[model samples]
Target chain A: MNATLNKPTSSTDVAQNGANRVNYVTPLANILESKDGYVLEAEMPGVNKDGLEVIVENGELTIVGRRAVAENRGREVYRESRAFDYRRAFELDPSIDTTKITAKIDQGVLTLHLPKAEAVKPRKITVG
Target chain B: MSIIRYQFPQVPNWSSSDRLASLRDEVNRLFDFSWPSRDSGLFSGWSPALDVFDDKDNLVVKVELPGLNKDEINISLDKGVLTVSGERKQEHESKEGESFRSERYFGKFHRSVTLPATVDSTKVSASYKDGILTVDLPKAEEAKPKQIAVNVA
Candidate 1:
């Protein structure tokens, strides 16, 4: 019984390449798989929507943004830890429909939705 | 001014301005320095948001700024030092929950970077679109790097 359920899981793995090297130097990201698509969540602490860029070029996805240092022209200062920039990139798999991928930056977190191709989506067949 | 004296052990007297200056220095040391080496609190992680590429006569700096208001951002170049500064504010309430998980950063931040060579500040152009700030710094005619070819006789 376990073998039957595992058969489909093995094929899904073949369709996805999860071997992208994680860059610890930048923000940490979490990838989630759903019934219809995959979601990517990146933690961009000081970044805002205006500072973020999501680009799909040459079949690769890249996210870039920066957090500016606060102006203290003539003011006194205290403990500080503001960072300059945030940049990350990922090579996409062929199973993902690049044209259908959508990205939204809300707050400092960037969320990307990559919809699987119709042929790759799981479907239940009916026999009359 | 009313003077109240309280005796403490091993306490040195410091002037008000001196104390304030020291405090300011401490804050600057903590927040206004170079890119952070590690991720700490929100806005504390460092990444090269701006990648500057120089080719002969032109210099391009691509800056990444997300969710920041245009009016709040200021970019200026004076005496060869390029300064970028802005502020971000936190929201008062949230529907997620009374105790919320906030990874977003809010407050002021500034970065001052010196240019590689003399640039024509008047000819500089900056455009912010799609959450990226691209600053074009045109180099002076004499400052552009010249390619020298070697001839073997």
Candidate 2:
């Protein structure tokens, strides 16, 4: 059985850019394990592959992207509730092979496949 | 002489409307405090996922954005700052109550990144494949490392 828990904590200092005032709009991600590899899924609703970025630096994984506002409708709007600048980071495990990491984004869900190294894969022993 | 008595109404649990109202208030407060204080059009809430590493030629930025079409994303560079922005829409579904928890991000997002060094923006290229956006920022000619040769007598 695969069980995961959700935890929410305030991260105010992560992005300190001055003009953009939206807060508490952090991207949520989930990590899953499969027989072939570990998969990471992130929800990025309005972002496309062009705006999305994935990188590995110094044993850390980072994903960055932006959501552009639509053309003005020429109507006065009272309130808006959309988030931008989805940022998230993770510390990659040393056991995983960084070179073999593969990622894909579909339908606002980003999926990453981290295949296990040859030494970590399960091996079958034969008895004569 | 007359005696007067007043009975106070009991307070109820916060209704959905009340919760939504409070959420709106909180959002308003954020804007009130942040908008009037900055001079540079630099907005405060852009946070993009970034990974920095050394490559053979340049530093690459890969971002993940799903549910967005290729035409929606825009990339531009001005005065050494890279700006990426796009929008995503929500699908319409007739069915309701199907989701136990819904926290997926929706709407417009903007991210402006300041490069560590001057980049060769002319040679920069971006590609989107399989919902992943990859931006290759080539290092400037002068920024590339030079090797020196030494002769010993």
Candidate 3:
């Protein structure tokens, strides 16, 4: 796992943090590779922009989402949805450009754009 | 009660009972998953969770279904029982790249539950926002809880 990958790996690794009130599950995600960069999408329902956290630490990319269920504090006749927190992490290598990583969330879905480092990106070779 | 598959690889040719009649009593015990425990293996099956509750005025059900379109959701209430069903498609087509690790589930799913109070079928409405589907079932006049005033000396 230490070797640098030629293509970015799809981070199917999901993590769930210790929640004080309710339990949670890891959201589903899809990862795709493009010429310029790699894209990661995650499904995080009921989470707002303020509840999302994306961090890069020690070459690891971590995503955490916390959805507020304060409104659901009322009486409950039946409850099945975990209504808790979400977390996921991925290991990155030197080939990825961490500074330029961009992400957006729409309709409860999150998309992260991880660009490849300039040196490692494929370049077109011309005939001599 | 069972682990749902992400892909509809095959469809059963026949059904013994009415497609949803069995759902009548089984919905109550549908999602008793032992969450909060760490999942094993590289990829785990993904299934959206739901919650159903009621207040003084209305009964509500909320489902976590991110990346799903409004057209994909369907809700039906009959015989004091409510059903919410839908499908989430794999967002992308099968590409040529090798899958490092796959864990997301896609396919059809339906959740059914019988409600405690009789609801006004005509006044029911649902709204989807931030990937959560909220179905509001207004309680019938008799089903609504009445707050009685107390007279103090």
Which candidate leads in lDDT?
A: 3
* Runs in model 1 lying further than 4 Å from the true structure: A1-128, B1-48, B147-153
Q: Residue B18 in model 1: shift from native, Å?
A: 27
Q: Residue A112 of model 1: what lDDT?
A: 80
Model 2: residue B5 alpha-carbon error in angstroms: 53
Comparing 1 with 2 on DockQ, the higher-scoring candidate is 2
Quick one: ranking by DockQ, best first? Answer: 3, 2, 1
- Per-residue error for A57 in candidate 2, Å, reads 37
Of 1 and 3, which scores higher on DockQ?
3
Looking at chain B only, the TM-scores across the models are 0.61, 0.63, 0.65
Assess candidate 1 and give its lDDT: 0.56
Per-residue error (Å), model 3, residue B10? 34
The runs of at least 3 residues in candidate 2 whose Cα sits more than 4 Å from the true structure, single-residue gaps closed, are A1-128, B1-48, B93-99, B151-153
lDDT tens per residue, model 2, A28-108: 665655444566667765566777889888877777766644333222211122334677767765556889998876756
Residue A92, model 2: Cα distance from true site in angstroms: 30
Ranking by lDDT: 3, 2, 1
Off by over 4 Å in 3: A1-24, B1-47, B146-153
